[model samples]
Target: MAAKGLILLLFFSGLVSSNVEKTIFLAPEAREIAHDAVLLGRRLPVLTPSNWSLRTKIDAEFPTEGSSQGKVSWFFLDNLTEYQRYEVRICWAATQPTAFTLKTYEPSVAWEQPDLRASIERFVPNSQQQDIRTGVAEPTSDQPRISSALVLQVSAAADYFTKNATLMSNVPLVDVDVVLDPYILNVFPRSLLPNAACIVLVAIGSFFVSRWVIALIDGLLRADAALEKKQQ
Candidate 1:
């Protein structure tokens, strides 16, 4: 029973240790924006890495469909960071291909428009997934301009490419997630050594504890046998 309790305690500890900060958005599958651009609702402001550690995740609040499920959002993310190794993952439930475009920009004070520095585009097929990761290796450069587009089948159906028109979606829901600290930490082997050590220590401790209990039982049995002899 004690061993069963210890196992249950360890299982619960793993669950508690694995929780992450989650922020959800009822992001549009598609929306027309300024300059005939397609965006996934408003800009998302992301905040992170205050102490050189950044972990964020964007995913559907649940597997449900339609707009009624999630919180209505504008500029969905609250902040974004640069000069860090990060990953941007977009997952959806549609069977049609979704055009995922990431546009990067440098803000300008004049309000004319932010300068579009770089644009990354991918046509994700069968609505599988589009994962964008920066710093694939050691020496990595900055990634992304800012906004995103999860254009679901609209471009496939209409002239969204040439018209530069913002459009809506036929599909139900989409989510963007940013949380991946555990994966990033594992990239460096040293980050995992301490956790491995802790597991070994626990196993060793449990073995020693069981041995002590067994020895105590044996000693008590021998003493009872001696007492029986004396009684005889």
Candidate 2:
């Protein structure tokens, strides 16, 4: 269904006219994925001038209805290539009781239930979730990119049949920000020299400031000792 939606989106996007202009979320960092929904959150504080590699964001809507287990959403990190690195982040919104579990593997691998969760689910402030979610999917080794499909499912102790199901079904929207932040390997040293120089200067300044502080404290102690000896 998600694939089908993308097909329709590709064909009809920019072709249709609306009474009011709809908001289009472009993968700003990852322009290769020119079309997609940009979730509310920043991937990193640092900025990149070039498109050496950018994190991919895929917009997905978690189903309000699912098996007794709760709502589930499936997504694929399809916009990947060989010889690349990324920091993938998947973000979702749900209540405290509703625990999210992720299952992912390379498409080439056998379709078996993963023994362990690829990442852990966390519920933080929406403001922080975007950034916190950034760390959810850490870079797996410094190796190049490998494509995979990720399945996120919500589960809780309360049953959907029960009247007081305080999670998943109640709050089904999940923000999957499978963002891939690239490493310095691809970036030219010249491009980074400016920031690197600034960092070096800051470190040197801090070093001198700390030494001066230490000398000041030492002088004060020596003066106090000398005064005490003279008084004696």
Error of 2 at 57 (Å): 12
What is the Å distance of residue 217 in model 2 from its true position?
A: 1.1
Residues 68-166, candidate 1: write the lDDT tens digits: 232222112212322223332333223322333322222221123332211112221212242322221221223323333221111111112223232
- Best candidate according to lDDT: 2
| Span of 10 residues, lowest total lDDT, candidate 1 | 151-160
Scored by CA lDDT, what does every candidate get? Answer: 0.32, 0.36
What residue pairs are clashing in model 2? Answer: 55-180, 84-144, 89-177, 91-175, 92-175
Among these predictions, the greatest TM-score belongs to 2
Off by over 4 Å in 2: 1-71, 78-83, 93-97, 105-171, 183-209, 229-232
lDDT of 2 by residue, 1-232 (tens): 9999999998776454222101111122222111111111112211122322223222123324533443333333434334444333333333222333434333223123232222121221332444423233334344443232222222322222435555434543433333334434644333356789999999999999999999999999999999999999
Quote the positional error of residue 103 for candidate 2 in Å: 3.8
